[model samples]
Target: MKFDVVIGNPPYNKGMDLDFVDLGYKISNKYTVMITPAKWQTTADDYSGCASKNINYKQFREMYVPHMSYVCFYPQSMEVFDIYQIDGNYREY
Candidate 1:
């Protein structure tokens, strides 16, 4: 099946967020929207302590960024969701 839009709030663990975004973009014909941690925007080397370190962020950025129409960020202090905070050593990511 094909879709015109793909939207999701994927888990923020182990770089799964980017995986979702990638899949979304692949399947969607018009738009792919994801609610994920903002860490993927930074250099992969910055994720040395987490699974995201393995992601080639440079390639991801080059491929996806140009196609993105809009992007948003919320401050760390702001609670975007009412759910409990994720537990991990790399909370920032």
Candidate 2:
């Protein structure tokens, strides 16, 4: 299937742990900063990160929203404590 515009209300929380051990995956970089927020509090290791408490937001952003042509969706409430604006440009739920 082909997609053009995508939108959704993403949950707000911490992050997730990624299985990069046997996946043979490579991000091509080390210092990557990613920002993940969900309603439920989850450990950063749940998605993609080096530590269970620290989530690799940069890797998450690259793996999830790596392209600029994609329309990202996100909830407004997540922006409450955030230092940046919640304007829609990339990365949704």
**Which candidate comes out best when scored by lDDT?**
1
Score each candidate by Cα lDDT.
0.70, 0.35
Candidate 1 versus truth, CA RMSD in Å, comes to: 4.4
Question: lDDT per residue, candidate 1, 22-48, as tens digits?
Answer: 888889989888987777787564444
RMSD of each: 4.4, 11.8
Q: After superposition, how far is residue 12 of candidate 1 from its true place, in Å?
A: 0.7
lDDT score for residue 57 of model 1: 61
lDDT of 2: 0.35
Q: Following a full C-alpha superposition, what root-mean-square deviation does model 2 have from the true structure?
A: 11.8
Best by TM-score: 1
